[model samples]
Target: MQSFFKTNWIHSLWLILLFAGSLVGETVTPKDRLIVETLIRLNRFDVSGNEKWKGAVQRYARSQRGEEGYFELVEQFSVEAELPELLRLVEEDPTSALSAKSVQLIFRLGEQKKLSRLLSGSPKKKANAIITLIGFVKTPEAQKLLDEHKALSAPATSVAKGAPALISTADDIKALAARTGNVKQGKVVFQKFCFACHKAGDLGLDFGPGLSEIGSKLPKSELLLAIVKPNAGISFDYEGWTVETKQGSFLAGIVSESDEELTVRMVGGVSQKVKKADIAKRTKMKASLMPEGLHLAMSEMELVDLVEFLSSLRTR
Candidate 1:
């Protein structure tokens, strides 16, 4: 139960329930009353298409100390004032499916240069933007942007077939799973690639989600699938973002932005901040923070062993 909570809290936040009832005769606390009223307003906006409701929602979100993922609400209602909320969502939840979808939406809206602005912002932003371009194939001018950032290219999880573990075909999955895995060797493999982003029994950083109880939740076959195609089942906890400033600089990682500034929590427990006034714009990408081709860094048997080690971690 505890393991599931760590993995599925984002899903909980995503599933906002609407108490579609009148509060005129009910008793409630101040916070609960505000939440209930806000939810009721959101429900009304859904049916009535009230333009004023859009502005009201935006103001209310601001009053709540800059709510995260409010971009979902903006897109739902076509809230013109909160169009910039799209970028905020990206910065706030870059690796999330919603952010990825948002990037495609940006392209459809003909904002190609916005990516360039993002690329010029920060190191991780450029890396994430590049990875996103690699993941989202249909974006216009994607190749051109990719060419410029060729120096910091991540393993192309979407199209590249160079790595042995970057698999999608059933044949690939079966072949890898059939390999004999030595638990000791698997621990070595885990320390090398998986530890940078994820931790297992105090061995790594917690930048990505915890994997201590992963085996308890998912089977070996599913674990292999997660490695070969990480974005296929990415958790929202690892959402990414890039914040660009007017001075032609940016920062990327997990972001916490209020009205005044953005605080980015990078891997290895690193963190940075930038003022909102200095920010020219922000960009989001649709790629896992864990790059593809970690398997490429090791042999095929090593990957099998890594999977074995991960499988050994039950909810202890």
Candidate 2:
């Protein structure tokens, strides 16, 4: 819905960033959100991911901690992107409330060497940091690191919460533009995520389009779009239909209609037959049978790997 199209999204961010060095204004306008979003657009920052983009953001935020939209920006970035700023927060100001998260992220990144280095030196506000790190990083070295300061810290605490990963289709497009995938890895990713619904070669169900030779039929960009935003362009015979029955049941899938009956074909090739007289309502769905936002389940790098695998499925 926003005006996001351009020659290059990252380059567009750089153009604005250059101006922001002197012109970094308040978070009053949409520009602040746009800048942060662009910085993290390529890679979703998780413990398992991201690059230096985290350091740049952390360094910039230190001065703006009390600013209007600070928390909103922190909520955006994730991944390897975090080790430095977070690790620094842990090592330098361990007593700071931020140190708890800093230690957690540092552990998630598995920067064992860096965590050990931080542990080797003692900081004043380290009790919470030590506790959080010990709870998360359970290596022998980490245990030793905690043992060295056992008396100074409290018992390690643990809390488990599931947070859904965030990644948009636009983000994947930009990230994949600069990266390549391993076909082998991509195939593994495909089996983990896509094999159930779409068929490729002799593998998978044929509930959706057969992708045995999709590489020959569609370009790379089109393939990515199909996966990330299947609702964007519904292919022929793949449009979904919703049929509400007199029995108060709702069935959605590809539909075959006859004078007296309706056949609804769903994922996994399951089909339901309904008498036309029993149908209370029949409507066409706007989106494809293929689900939207599937990209959320995969990391950006894994997606790149998947596209690489899909692209390789061409005619001989």
Candidate 3:
């Protein structure tokens, strides 16, 4: 009898501990692919929803609260009605992308009247927000604010300083790739630059599309084009998307697919789906999700090596 009672007591204690952990979010795992995928699919970019969507949002928000997904939820949910919440978060965490996205939504929602008030906040906070603003708003007022704060921002770490500049043009780079390609050295270069967003063989994450079989697919010229000017041919499923909703929220991602439902996949590999009726406006973006000027960071030989490495990715 005592053994059975002790077993029940241990089981009850274990359950209580798990319940407590769930309440504080200690049970939340960042690498939980199912939860992450669910968060992505349910996000319609519009938080103003019916009971069903609202419950999903609230449930996930509670589970993922205080995680990065929480900030993402706050950012996705930012609308005209939520400006006060956005502003408070921006003021508290100006250096965060969450705050930057909030600021972008404010401008897109035609709430420029509030900009001056944000500018009047603490000089450092205002400056941080302005750094994100100048890129979106090109007006003289915005430019002037940027000029004042630009010097305060830290410069990006240089990938390549003053070095021997042999060639940068696409034709020349391709020719270089044909001549002196070193797969091993190229792998090193890729690990340094592209590995974070790309998966090559067993290396790196799947944030961007996997390149394990890229060489088998794309010809040499096409590969060169992808390297030099990524925007020249945005992949069909990977095309960029900028979404705005009637609630005043803004979202940017790659629109993966939309039939009865729409799916937007973010750069971090999180995908969200929304009903077709919920999206206020969706635009195909003009730019590649990959940033330009990556070649500028590499030595001429480094570029050749990287291309050669990618080109070697043929059949198994």
Q: TM-score of every model? A: 0.48, 0.46, 0.55
Model 3 misplacement above 4 A: 1-13, 16-151, 154-159, 162-171, 219-222, 257-260
- lDDT for predicted candidate 1 compared with the true structure: 0.59
Computed on alpha carbons, the lDDT of every model, listed in order, comes to 0.59, 0.60, 0.60
lDDT of 3 by residue, 88-129 (tens): 666775544445445545554556556556654556535433
Tens digits of lDDT, candidate 2, 54-154: 44555455445545443334434433434566676667655343453455445434565676666546553354435443433333445656675554444
lDDT of 3: 0.60
Candidate 1: deviation at residue 74, Å?
Answer: 38
**In model 3, how large is the Cα lDDT of residue 226?**
79
Question: Residue 153 CA error for candidate 3 (Å)?
Answer: 3.5
lDDT tens per residue, model 1, 212-298: 888798877788888877777668756777666797644556777798888766554334467788889777757766666556546
Task: TM-score winner between 1 and 3, please give it.
Answer: 3
Query: If candidate 3 were superposed on the true structure by all CA atoms, what would the RMSD be?
Result: 8.5
Error of 3 at 173 (Å): 2.6
Q: Candidate 2 versus the native: TM-score?
A: 0.46
